[model samples]
Target: MNERPRGIESVLVVGTGLIGTSVALALREHGVTVKLTDQSPGAVRVACELGAGDEWEPGGDRVDLAVIAVPPQFVADWLLDLQKTEAARFYTDVASVKALPIEQARRLGCDLSAYVAGHPLAGRERSGPGAARADVFLGRPWAYCPGRETSPRAVAAVLSLIELCGGNAVKVDPVAHDEAVALISHAPHVAASAVAARLVGASDTALGLAGPGVRDVTRVAGGDPDLWTVILSGNARPVAEVLEAVATDLAAAAAALRAVSVDDDGAIARVTELLRRGNAGRSRIPGKHGGPARAYAVVQVLVGDRPGELARLFQVAQDAGVNIEDVRLEHAPGLPLGAAELSVQPESAEVLAEALRSHGWHVP
Candidate 1:
């Protein structure tokens, strides 16, 4: 937080699903008066019970801002209705697909002057208010796409909301936002689902050999299918375009693999070239603070699968004055031991490793 943000002391959060409830909870943490509502009264009650906000009524007083967190298809209609009633001075939506919503708003003849479309590039596999967390948006990119008719005041208020929620606001055009998300978020989620779909009725013997890599690759596939179906449908064309490109690459890789059996001279090169391109693409993903990835030295330590093991290891690193930049845990099946991979600065790696070794931890 570079500066203290000030805007929208009171907010009406429409749709108390995961994103809405999370935004409400985040706003609540910043002392904003959050009034929550959803189509389902039970959802609103759950969010309110979680201290996200108070249950909003139909004819409540106009608030400084209103956040519509409904699915993409309904965002325009919600914006239209809210603006018609002057429910808030300014409004924004958290739907991931931006272009369609903005276009739909235009088609519906809604007032866009006070509305900005936004999408926070952060979420959990779980949906609903019970899965919402105040810190979910911390350090994540919150994109706001202002239409041609949007007012500067509305944009500023949206930026303030993003800041208050501990997110970095990224200003982008609506169509460009859709394309970018389609490539990164939407396409990848569908790809993950496709991969996970292969596991249906898979043998236990095959699944037993799985490791962290498979889990990481298929993690997003666990998201709600109905919700994702709506998301994929909203951004269909862009997502389809990206998926087509991916399918082409995958088809080529498979062909190259098949060629290997016939002893084709170029088969290995073809597959290797695809792998190299994948490495290049993976490296291009932004790291901390939307910057280039930094090389951190990983210190691996074998630990007993017991309570307080990770805490003790972290405490050791703290006492050694070595800040662990990141951490990943590895579980050993059918064994009471696992490995903790601690990422630290190159200079501190040896110090942290030595500290753990001194604490009777196996640094293998």
Candidate 2:
């Protein structure tokens, strides 16, 4: 097949951690040749074993694209080092924070025409190659920032790379990218960590009462602290600004709750307004396929924590010609039972519920 202008046929993936290995795996899925390298030999070996790609060696032919999947602080320097060796015809990075890295690249006199900074807004709370999945970036927004010096060739190459990984390319300014992610990703992680930290010395009773709400709120707190530290430090100002707003709201809520001890009607109004604002903010989040926010009907089923139980639930839904749009599980701690909250179209909810009930399954 004839390729487009310097289309990405082969790629060199640096840093075989979660993002790098995931990108390599995704490219391999699309029949793109991938070469892997990392600071840790063991890490790269694991990635290769996981079918991400083959190991890289010096003096090999320069690839069409190089993905520098290191941290934000190290991305620019790594780009400079790789460019000195002509690692690829075009280059990009998977560092979440963009402005600082682009600035560093300029300060180092790197060839900006060959580089585009990118970040895929997708990841698990876990880290390392073991946590990498080829589908991690599927349907996710891949943000790209090409500076004034960036060549059209570089932008085209990275766009192909994002498409190969099942991502939608979104062009953004470097500083704006940092600010946006600060509001959405970085600051939320810090807030999650703060809430999770409060659970450190809780009593067993309090812990037992913990449910999916707490888990969902604190889920991202499980991310690698050292890595998050680098990302937050790179976009300190924007993240700090977001955190300040969050703190103000939280402090207000606390004060309003304390005032309710005196049977204050104004305090109740204040708390209610905060909750209403939260509902508004949540509703603004994009739903499936980047469409308008939708409200799906939920069908809850008691699930057995054993093999094939969840599959059986899906089978029932399928037999009823119902599609499951989303799912959330609430496990009964120390028990072998849980609730599988299936989200489907409002029209499909009763059909699925009836199917499950007829199949000797408890649908609640």
Off by over 4 Å in 2: 1-6, 288-364
TM-score of each: 0.80, 0.79
Q: Of the candidates shown, which would achieve the greatest lDDT relative to the real structure?
A: 2
Over the stretch 1-364, how does candidate 1's per-residue lDDT look in tens digits?
A: 1223397788999999999998998787667889998999999999999988898876879999999999999999999998888889999999989999999999999888999999998777778888786756754678999877899999999998987776768999888998999998999999999999999979999999999999989988988899989999999999999999999999999999899989897887988999999888887764322225576778999977653356556668878998765555566554888877776777998898889989999998
Clash pairs (backbone) in predicted model 1:
none
For model 1, the superposed segments whose C-alpha errors exceed 4 Å read: 1-5, 288-364
Cα lDDT tens digits, model 2, 139-186, are 468999998899999999999998777576899999999999998899
Candidate 2 local Cα displacement, residue 219, angstroms: 1.2
lDDT to native, each model: 0.85, 0.86
lDDT of 1: 0.85
Candidate maximizing TM-score? 1
